[model samples]
Target: MPEGQVITVTGPRPVSALGVVDAHDHLLIDSPGMPGQGFADVALSTVEARDGVASGITTLVEMTPIGLGRNPAGLRAISKHSGLAIIAASGFHRDAHYPAGSWVYDAPVELLRDRIVTDLTRGMHPADWHDPSLPLDEARAGAIKGGASYHHISHAERRRLEAIGAASAATGAAVLVHTEIGTAAHEIVDLLEAAGATTDRIALAHLDRNPDWELHAEVAARGVTLEYDTIGRTKYHPDSVVLDLIERVAAAGHLDRIVLGLDLGARSYLRAYDGGPGMRYLMTAFVPRLRRRLGDDAVARILIANPARLYAMPVAGGAASPG
Candidate 1:
């Protein structure tokens, strides 16, 4: 693979090709943690993805980690059908997303680390590593996904984080960590850094759930990206809250560290399922408002330039194999 390219399901492409990105989102996810809420239909996903594309999104970073219904082959099909660049994830989610007797809970650090590296450099396991004998999917995972508990990191979660950090260190892949309601932001970064992942390659998802500008500014100052995906999530708070936080963070001189996404992670969150906001909400609804508040240059940076930097695979050895 060449330098300064993003590893998408279709194959590697130049960073410049990723125009206007949704830095965090999910196209296929099925987890016991959210009962009866998983969406796996590739046709519906392609429909939703096309809507997003029509609304001005060029790429989507699918953050459904392993064992949480991450279908790489299905993602590839959706990408081809929808004309959307999809960057898949490899790693694990929080403890709640896995079952009590699942192998993810007991897998050692080395096994977990190798799985992630294989997903990045080789291909993601079609069965999410449930059956390693199965052939690998042609679509490769471009980024790593890991999560922490609410203000705490469990034993299993800690092990997974260690593995994620090691894989990131070895491959120079970007990592996206799910922060529960935005808790343990600094602590998550600390552990990943201690495990050899650099702050620049780390992004804390759902940081807007906390909505603390001071904390966001501090984290951004540390060279870590802050992903705000609460757009149109009225259940959490109004879009104004996120807008205010972005303005404050930008004022604090960390605008370059901010990225935006809708994070429509559930079936009910998609318009194809007769849901509200859908994937188009970010670009069609909130982005116009964001442009009014911050002007086109800042919005372009948030929607385009920042994601290009955050999701770009390291221009070094260890990136995923070309599809």
Candidate 2:
């Protein structure tokens, strides 16, 4: 692997080698908590990544962590078959995504840290389900993700965040945290920094849903990356609304701290499920809108430069080791 390489599911490649990147996305999301026909399909994911490549997206960050059906082998297959640089996540999502009494809730901090560290260094098969027959996965994680609940960070989530922070500090992998409606963004940063995580290596996802310029500027001033991923979903806000927010943040002199994502997790967001806009929506549509609004230089920063820098692991080889 080369220096300044971005870790993919297959291996690490140079940052300059990457083209455009979707900073936050869930290539496949399958948990017991997700509906049966909601949005978990390898075939669909293959098309998603492949189609994005057609429109100039060279990389994708898969934000589905452990306990959320983070199919590492599935991700590897998608990357192999699609020829896309895919980065898999290792950590926990919101507590509601898991069943009651799951190990994520009750596991000791050291245990959680070791599990995430192994996923980063060695492989990404999370559990055996009390059965000895299941095998470990060969695909390794490129990033770590953790999250809190609505309006409050629970004790369990905090413990997991601390463990995730420790794993990140050890591995130098970027941290993607789910902010419930964008609350506790600063608090999350404080906790990760307290646990020895790097502020520049942290990306707070879904803050665009909240759409607060002052707050976003505040967080970006702290050296954290902000990912605005809810594009093409008119149910939220128009694409221009997000573009406007980006303009505000850029004008605040924090342009380097910004990134983008498609966040096409829902079944309806999939073209295979008649989700028309598809994964190319960002590269094809919103990016053009951004270019028109913010010029090609800013476009390059958000889609190419920002993500490559943020997602690069501290110790780069192929997969990062917890050394």
Candidate 3:
């Protein structure tokens, strides 16, 4: 609608109003990749969202892509009930999330691009395009989501990424690409760039999973934002590892390119579901520690300024209206 505004599930909001953002997270997601871990209850999701708000988060970027049980209407309900600005995602994940012979796997690049543009401009399909005749939900997706396999981009994944890049170029929306354990960073950037999406519009999610400061610095230098969301996943590595990576990257003059999130994408990761390190963990535990290590100004940039800039929709001349 306007420059410096982000399209939330409910409507468009200025980036300045988005305080203490969790740049990457999920409200409701059901996928075959993680059996029995999907959480779809609206009330339960609202409860978890309230926990995030109470812990100082004002906005959450719900990163559940298409064909992965994206509940746009439910997300709008949760946003209303929880008082959180929710930015839903459109586009596709890696091919692994889709069943064999699913439309997502066989759809040509044009159909995939149209679906994403429709979600961003008109509204998200209530059934995620399973039934095209179904009415569109009022909650439009504010960002595009794409994914790559472990150190590889399959034929289908590449096609989806191309669609994502095209949609992003057409709508001037930000894109969040899911990198498998942080692999294929350069390749993902190259493909999206070649497809017409600028590096500034692209963010590589879960880059912390790899935790290689040298690689991160190189990517950041290319003007691509780096999203670190493995905040409490001790199985990956201690928080110290990410903290060290951030410090190193910041020292390399790329602090502004950094953003943070908890990315609790499962039911078991929510306190409402009796899980550890729930949505509040980012603000209640990790952030205070981050502030102690890097002063308030630095933490503010990470939690506030950086995400605001990264997620804001560009004011393209022919961009689709946020209907």
Per-residue alpha-carbon lDDT of candidate 3 for residues 1-323, written as tens digits (9 for 90 to 100): 12478889988888888988899999899986788999989999899999999999999999999888989999999999999999999989997788887899888998999999999988899987999999999888899999999999999999999989988888888899999999999999999998889998999999999999999999999999999999999888999999899999999999999999888888889999888689999998898888888899999999899988888887632247432
As for TM-score, the candidate ahead, 2 or 3, is 3
Q: What is the C-alpha local distance difference test score of each model?
A: 0.91, 0.83, 0.90
- Residue 216, model 2: Cα distance from true site in angstroms: 0.6
Superior candidate under lDDT, 2 versus 3: 3
- Clash tally, candidates in order: 0, 0, 0
- Lowest-lDDT window of 10 residues in candidate 2? 126-135
Q: 218-308, model 2: which lDDT tens digit per residue?
A: 9999999998987887888899889999999999999998999987766777786677678889988888889999999889988888988
Error of 1 at 31 (Å): 0.9
Tens-digit lDDT track for model 1 on 1-323? 12388889999888888998999999998987898899999998899999999999999999999898878989999999999999999989999899889999888899999999999998889988999999999888899999999999999999999999988988888999999999999999999999899999999999999999999999999999999999999999999999999999999999999999888888899998788789999988898888889999999888888888887877643464422
TM-score of decoy 3: 0.97
Where does model 3 exceed 4 Å of error?
Answer: 1-3, 316-323
